[model samples]
Target: MPEHSDLGLLVLPEAVCLAEALCDLDWRRYVAMVELNFDLTQFYDHVAHRLGQPRMFARSIAWNRDGDPLRRWVMAHCGRHKQTRNQYWDRVRRHQLPLVHSGR
Candidate 1:
Protein backbone atom coordinates (compact mmCIF):
# COMPACT_ATOMS: atom_id res chain seq x y z
CA MET A 1 0.00 0.00 0.00
CA PRO A 2 1.08 3.55 -0.60
CA GLU A 3 2.71 5.26 2.37
CA HIS A 4 1.46 8.73 1.53
CA SER A 5 -1.46 10.31 -0.25
CA ASP A 6 -1.12 12.64 -3.21
CA LEU A 7 -1.22 15.56 -0.76
CA GLY A 8 1.99 14.16 0.78
CA LEU A 9 0.37 13.42 4.10
CA LEU A 10 1.44 10.39 6.03
CA VAL A 11 -0.94 7.60 5.13
CA LEU A 12 1.28 4.75 6.17
CA PRO A 13 -0.34 2.20 8.41
CA GLU A 14 2.70 2.19 10.65
CA ALA A 15 2.53 5.96 11.03
CA VAL A 16 -1.15 5.87 11.86
CA CYS A 17 -0.50 3.13 14.40
CA LEU A 18 2.26 5.16 15.97
CA ALA A 19 -0.01 8.19 16.18
CA GLU A 20 -2.67 6.16 17.93
CA ALA A 21 -0.19 4.79 20.44
CA LEU A 22 1.19 8.22 21.15
CA CYS A 23 -2.22 9.82 21.50
CA ASP A 24 -3.40 7.22 24.01
CA LEU A 25 -0.82 8.43 26.50
CA ASP A 26 -1.70 10.93 29.21
CA TRP A 27 -1.07 14.55 28.23
CA ARG A 28 1.76 15.00 30.68
CA ARG A 29 3.38 11.77 29.66
CA TYR A 30 3.00 12.63 26.01
CA VAL A 31 4.68 15.98 26.56
CA ALA A 32 7.52 14.35 28.41
CA MET A 33 7.87 11.65 25.79
CA VAL A 34 7.91 14.13 22.92
CA GLU A 35 9.89 16.83 24.71
CA LEU A 36 7.38 19.23 23.25
CA ASN A 37 9.18 22.29 24.56
CA PHE A 38 11.87 21.63 22.02
CA ASP A 39 11.74 22.55 18.38
CA LEU A 40 9.47 20.54 16.11
CA THR A 41 12.45 19.33 14.11
CA GLN A 42 13.46 17.36 17.18
CA PHE A 43 10.02 15.87 17.26
CA TYR A 44 10.36 14.80 13.64
CA ASP A 45 13.75 13.35 14.39
CA HIS A 46 12.45 11.42 17.37
CA VAL A 47 9.50 10.01 15.49
CA ALA A 48 11.58 9.15 12.47
CA HIS A 49 14.05 7.25 14.63
CA ARG A 50 11.30 5.51 16.52
CA LEU A 51 9.53 4.43 13.32
CA GLY A 52 12.70 3.58 11.42
CA GLN A 53 11.46 5.77 8.62
CA PRO A 54 13.84 8.70 8.67
CA ARG A 55 13.86 9.06 4.92
CA MET A 56 10.11 9.19 4.67
CA PHE A 57 9.73 11.72 7.46
CA ALA A 58 12.60 13.83 6.21
CA ARG A 59 11.20 13.93 2.71
CA SER A 60 7.78 14.80 4.01
CA ILE A 61 9.09 17.68 6.04
CA ALA A 62 11.25 18.85 3.15
CA TRP A 63 8.26 18.89 0.87
CA ASN A 64 6.41 21.02 3.46
CA ARG A 65 3.32 18.86 3.17
CA ASP A 66 3.94 15.92 5.43
CA GLY A 67 3.89 15.78 9.24
CA ASP A 68 0.75 17.98 9.50
CA PRO A 69 -1.37 15.03 10.51
CA LEU A 70 1.14 13.84 13.06
CA ARG A 71 1.58 17.36 14.40
CA ARG A 72 -2.15 17.85 14.67
CA TRP A 73 -2.52 14.51 16.36
CA VAL A 74 0.11 15.37 18.91
CA MET A 75 -1.35 18.81 19.54
CA ALA A 76 -4.82 17.40 19.94
CA HIS A 77 -3.62 14.97 22.58
CA CYS A 78 -1.05 16.95 24.54
CA GLY A 79 -0.44 20.45 25.91
CA ARG A 80 -3.62 20.50 27.91
CA HIS A 81 -2.10 21.10 31.29
CA LYS A 82 -4.35 24.03 32.06
CA GLN A 83 -7.41 22.25 30.76
CA THR A 84 -6.64 19.21 32.90
CA ARG A 85 -6.24 21.37 35.99
CA ASN A 86 -9.48 23.16 35.29
CA GLN A 87 -11.23 19.84 34.87
CA TYR A 88 -9.93 18.69 38.22
CA TRP A 89 -11.24 21.82 39.90
CA ASP A 90 -14.56 21.42 38.16
CA ARG A 91 -14.81 17.89 39.48
CA VAL A 92 -14.03 19.06 42.96
CA ARG A 93 -16.69 21.75 42.74
CA ARG A 94 -19.23 19.30 41.45
CA HIS A 95 -18.64 16.43 43.89
CA GLN A 96 -16.95 17.92 46.95
CA LEU A 97 -19.03 20.93 47.80
CA PRO A 98 -20.75 19.78 50.98
CA LEU A 99 -20.08 23.13 52.71
CA VAL A 100 -21.71 25.05 49.87
CA HIS A 101 -24.60 22.61 49.74
CA SER A 102 -25.17 22.98 53.48
CA GLY A 103 -25.12 26.80 53.13
CA ARG A 104 -22.23 26.99 55.59
Candidate 2:
Protein backbone atom coordinates (compact mmCIF):
# COMPACT_ATOMS: atom_id res chain seq x y z
CA MET A 1 0.00 0.00 0.00
CA PRO A 2 1.05 3.55 -0.58
CA GLU A 3 2.17 5.66 2.33
CA HIS A 4 -0.18 8.53 3.07
CA SER A 5 0.73 11.33 5.44
CA ASP A 6 -2.64 11.20 7.17
CA LEU A 7 -2.30 7.65 8.46
CA GLY A 8 1.00 8.45 10.18
CA LEU A 9 -0.02 7.92 13.74
CA LEU A 10 2.72 6.42 15.82
CA VAL A 11 1.80 3.20 17.66
CA LEU A 12 -1.65 3.15 16.07
CA PRO A 13 -2.31 0.01 14.12
CA GLU A 14 -5.79 1.22 13.23
CA ALA A 15 -4.27 4.05 11.31
CA VAL A 16 -2.26 1.62 9.28
CA CYS A 17 -5.29 -0.48 8.60
CA LEU A 18 -7.33 2.55 7.64
CA ALA A 19 -4.62 3.81 5.35
CA GLU A 20 -4.27 0.49 3.63
CA ALA A 21 -8.01 0.07 3.31
CA LEU A 22 -8.63 3.48 1.87
CA CYS A 23 -5.63 3.35 -0.41
CA ASP A 24 -6.77 0.08 -1.84
CA LEU A 25 -10.24 1.35 -2.64
CA ASP A 26 -11.22 2.94 -5.88
CA TRP A 27 -11.72 6.70 -5.80
CA ARG A 28 -15.46 6.40 -6.42
CA ARG A 29 -15.82 3.89 -3.64
CA TYR A 30 -13.87 6.13 -1.34
CA VAL A 31 -16.10 9.09 -2.16
CA ALA A 32 -19.20 7.00 -1.62
CA MET A 33 -17.90 5.80 1.71
CA VAL A 34 -17.27 9.30 2.88
CA GLU A 35 -20.47 10.75 1.52
CA LEU A 36 -22.56 8.00 3.02
CA ASN A 37 -20.52 7.91 6.22
CA PHE A 38 -20.71 4.15 6.04
CA ASP A 39 -17.56 2.10 5.98
CA LEU A 40 -15.27 5.05 6.55
CA THR A 41 -17.05 6.15 9.70
CA GLN A 42 -17.19 2.60 11.03
CA PHE A 43 -13.48 2.22 10.56
CA TYR A 44 -12.91 5.53 12.29
CA ASP A 45 -15.34 4.85 15.11
CA HIS A 46 -13.84 1.47 15.85
CA VAL A 47 -10.37 2.88 15.97
CA ALA A 48 -11.34 5.78 18.16
CA HIS A 49 -13.30 3.59 20.56
CA ARG A 50 -10.54 1.02 20.85
CA LEU A 51 -7.81 3.57 21.33
CA GLY A 52 -9.89 5.86 23.57
CA GLN A 53 -8.73 8.72 21.46
CA PRO A 54 -10.30 11.57 19.61
CA ARG A 55 -9.14 13.90 16.85
CA MET A 56 -6.66 11.46 15.39
CA PHE A 57 -9.15 10.13 12.88
CA ALA A 58 -10.12 13.59 11.78
CA ARG A 59 -6.51 14.60 11.86
CA SER A 60 -5.69 11.75 9.55
CA ILE A 61 -8.47 12.68 7.17
CA ALA A 62 -7.50 16.30 7.28
CA TRP A 63 -3.87 15.53 6.68
CA ASN A 64 -4.64 13.19 3.82
CA ARG A 65 -7.19 15.09 1.78
CA ASP A 66 -6.13 18.71 2.13
CA GLY A 67 -8.37 20.53 -0.34
CA ASP A 68 -10.84 17.70 -0.65
CA PRO A 69 -14.40 18.61 0.38
CA LEU A 70 -14.83 15.47 2.40
CA ARG A 71 -11.75 16.36 4.38
CA ARG A 72 -13.10 19.81 5.01
CA TRP A 73 -16.45 18.52 6.22
CA VAL A 74 -14.74 15.99 8.47
CA MET A 75 -12.44 18.56 10.03
CA ALA A 76 -15.15 21.12 10.52
CA HIS A 77 -17.95 18.98 11.91
CA CYS A 78 -16.16 15.83 13.06
CA GLY A 79 -13.00 17.32 14.50
CA ARG A 80 -14.28 19.96 16.83
CA HIS A 81 -11.85 18.97 19.60
CA LYS A 82 -14.76 18.45 21.94
CA GLN A 83 -16.02 14.91 21.60
CA THR A 84 -15.24 11.27 20.95
CA ARG A 85 -16.16 9.73 17.65
CA ASN A 86 -17.05 13.20 16.57
CA GLN A 87 -16.93 12.18 12.97
CA TYR A 88 -19.36 9.36 13.43
CA TRP A 89 -21.34 10.44 16.45
CA ASP A 90 -21.66 13.99 15.46
CA ARG A 91 -23.53 13.00 12.35
CA VAL A 92 -25.55 10.57 14.37
CA ARG A 93 -26.45 13.13 17.00
CA ARG A 94 -27.13 16.00 14.68
CA HIS A 95 -28.34 14.29 11.56
CA GLN A 96 -29.93 11.18 12.97
CA LEU A 97 -27.99 9.13 10.49
CA PRO A 98 -27.07 5.70 11.68
CA LEU A 99 -24.19 3.59 10.47
CA VAL A 100 -24.95 1.69 7.31
CA HIS A 101 -22.76 -1.15 6.23
CA SER A 102 -22.04 -1.05 2.50
CA GLY A 103 -20.73 -4.58 2.38
CA ARG A 104 -17.17 -3.40 2.26
- Please state the error at residue 49 of candidate 2 in Å: 5.3
User: What would the per-residue lDDT of candidate 1 be over residues 27-94, giving only the tens digit for each residue?
Assistant: 33544444333434555555676677765674465346444776665555445554764575588678
State which candidate has the highest lDDT. 1
Q: Could you tell me the lDDT of residue 37 within candidate 2?
A: 44
TM-scores, all candidates, are 0.37, 0.23
Clashing pairs in model 2, backbone N/Cα/C closer than 3 A? none
Model 2 / residue 7 / CA error / Å:
22
What's the lDDT for candidate 2?
Answer: 0.51
Q: For model 1, what is the alpha-carbon lDDT of residue 19?
A: 67
The Cα error of candidate 1 at residue 74, in Å, is: 1.3
